[model samples]
Target: MAVRSYFLDCASLRDYLQGIWHEVAYDGLNSVVAGALVQLAFGVVKQTESDVFADFPGQVSYETLERIITRGNTQKAEKEFSAARHALVPDDQSQESDEAFVDLKEYMLSDAYRNLVDFIVDYQKNRNGFPTMKMLMHTTPWDPGFDLQQATKEERLEWRRVYTINWLYVTW
Candidate 1:
């Protein structure tokens, strides 16, 4: 909230930029996170809820989470999130319950990314690795130029229609 509001105007983007020096910045997400999450979040900039939800279910399908994480809001969002996100992961046993750190490490590199690692991690953490397959293919970002050849325009349109329904009824 603070970041968006603060930088709502280009005039403020300059102010924040001036405040920072000698810092390596990406997306201006104010914290230094685990490199893996940073990779997922920044690596695949998303345009739809299904794309993000299919990958990261535990995360609220709301930009509020990003806004809170990056420029302000801080722990408040985290606390509210944990309370509401359990449904995303309905599994009785976490596949890596016994090996937490190892799993996080392995998950970051798994083939599951399919081009949207951040989204997948969100699903794994929140949805319990249970988002449907169609959801995955539809929401995951494909390189605009590269994916266009691999996927027909009609197929993309169909996926967009499905996503529109899913977001409208299920997520929204």
Candidate 2:
């Protein structure tokens, strides 16, 4: 079978993000679980489609989406890093730290993110299936020094939702 790619408009993506952000952000476990369940419902839409759909006006390709994501991530990371740097203690009358921090942009755009996107797209388009639990676990990203076994319940849930959000972002 010929492989196909999904495309969506910027407005649609923005609106979807807003909705999910509203639903999932800072409410409670119930809200987060609701978001996860809604994401599963989202999978149903993906599963029902079996055609090579034509691109629509204002719809962006994956490359376009990648650029958009990169731009947004860069801006957010910059603001966050700037805030963090300013919050740090002054060293020898200098506000800026002599020590260098990890590049936020590079970390945000790391291969893990790309691999997760690739895995989802391939599973949906070429295999016409969802990833197994093992595949999902391996592909999902965690903090560099995070220890899953030592994490609290909330931490586990937060980490679990990150991948769900990424899947919904790409596949929705």
Candidate 3:
């Protein structure tokens, strides 16, 4: 199935991610994968041939990006993500940490994340609905670098970089 279909049918964000990876990795003969790979290859070659390429620092090659998206180094990504999680919410504390990424399962099952997902699903079904203050507050824990509890209600409402989800699956 296509990525969009995966999104539509997915029971959770983790499921969606797995479905997307499966589409990219498991079926090289699939037209979607074949066409997308060809297009990306062409774009990479064209960009490489351009004069301004030298201006772009840390430029990633097509092969690198392809490996990242299609077949990530799962063991390494898991280890890195685990270490980050441990650093953020250390063994002694229950307080939320300022980490930007977490294990997919941890993120999906979090109260804040689940609330956001519910809001999105509701919005999709209703087509018109603004999340209440409670819904917004539910996401405060996941806001990186922002301690909502430290701020007053009015200030907390202005929280930036609020993410429904942020995860890293590394290839290298």
Candidate 4:
């Protein structure tokens, strides 16, 4: 019997977010912010795929299996992201040390990130289901645990970088 297939491609997810970003204008939101949020969402989905499909056998394709098995690559990407995120702030002062010294870039990025998540939730709620691959390449349900509200400047920056890497990997 032929195996049933369902997969989410990074390139497709990036494109979908790009489209939404273009059409919708959330306060203080832009393409870069949208891209970063999309990356976080992608990571959340990818990280949870195992549990999401635990009950189903042979549902995940070989390509997905290969991607999942390369845990080292994912970890490396995340570490690179973390470094880039930390580099956004001053070395002399930590982000937590000075709430007054608000990094406008980080603030804007975080707000946009939260707004995007709310948008997705609303979209799903209205549709009464998760989007299909054709509608949006999201494979797993949107995880509420992926919150960036209290995330430090470095963490937010890391999420952006991760998305950027995913975008490049998918496009090229």
Candidate 5:
């Protein structure tokens, strides 16, 4: 389901995420297991080869985007998303630390990582909303756990380097 996927509206994306997260969290997977699954699912995630949604319009619907992101792998994506959130920001203290990425006003000002965050935001703005990590993860297509381990160091780093803080879209 990685090669191609349909864009989605918001409700569908949220449902997808909630469903997957519930399943993964149901068994209380350990941090190690959860983290591994997140890497696996996000790996298969991909952008459309071409912009089929591009046209004279405001933005893609959230439900449409959900399908686009999940690429039919809601289970894997949501599980990993929940795992990553738990790993990266397990508590209030961890959340503070994670903020360091977007904490730097310079990064936000320079737009260094804004493009990536904007991708999801701009689409969600259509319906006056934003997607949570779990929502986005469930909706997005991603790799399996083993492939994440097999990827090159650079590939893994690139995946990890994404601005999760920015994904939160908080402007202070």
Candidate 6:
């Protein structure tokens, strides 16, 4: 029998993170920031599908949804999660010392981004028994193809033109 790997769909992943988010303190990070970080990680993994998926069949299957469910010692998990979120906060000291502007784009490339990726990767890896396929985040010039004029006001507010796609693969 071919060993199958389990993976979380976007919704499942979002739900799992929501549970974590609720357990942890905001620590200067809100749900939107957490969600964006997750999407960015996904995008990084998607970019590597060509290279990573070559060993397996091109066809993909979803793992059982239950695998993504968050459970146990939520209080402890919350504390750890809060710490990770806190790590992502832009250093006010840097801004004061150098008068440097730390923007969202910079945060995507910061140590906090790395920690968030590590935290998510570790959780998913342990929870689903999968290994990290890829984790990355990057920003580029806004795509003109996403015509803001054509988007509804609500859509424009919710739209992330530069979001990343995340993927996790496991071999059993």
Clashes of 6: 5
Best by TM-score: 2
Best by lDDT: 2
lDDT of 3 by residue, 11-77 (tens): 2434544565577687554757656655665564455434233443476343333234234553444
Candidate 2 lDDT tens digits, 1-172: 1111222232234356566667566654467666775686566435422232232235434444444444646555445332224334555453653544444433333344555566666567546455656556654674656788999865765565565545654575
Of 3 and 5, the candidate ranking higher by lDDT? 3
Candidate 6, pairs of clashing residues: 42-165, 42-166, 43-164, 43-165, 43-166
Each candidate's number of clashing pairs is 11, 0, 0, 0, 25, 5
Instruction: Give per-residue lDDT, candidate 4, residue 126.
Output: 47
lDDT of each: 0.39, 0.49, 0.43, 0.46, 0.41, 0.39
Which ranges of candidate 3 are over 4 A from the true structure? 1-116, 124-126, 140-143, 146-162, 165-172
Model 4 vs. true fold: TM: 0.24
Reference-based TM-score of each model = 0.18, 0.28, 0.21, 0.24, 0.23, 0.23
Which residue runs of candidate 4 sit more than 4 Å off their true CA positions? Answer: 1-20, 23-28, 62-171
User: In the order shown, what is each candidate's alpha-carbon RMSD?
Assistant: 21.4, 12.4, 19.5, 15.8, 18.9, 18.9
Q: After superposition, how far is residue 17 of candidate 5 from its true place, in Å?
A: 6.2
Candidate closer to the true structure by TM-score (higher is better), 4 or 5: 4
Output the better candidate (5/6) by lDDT. 5
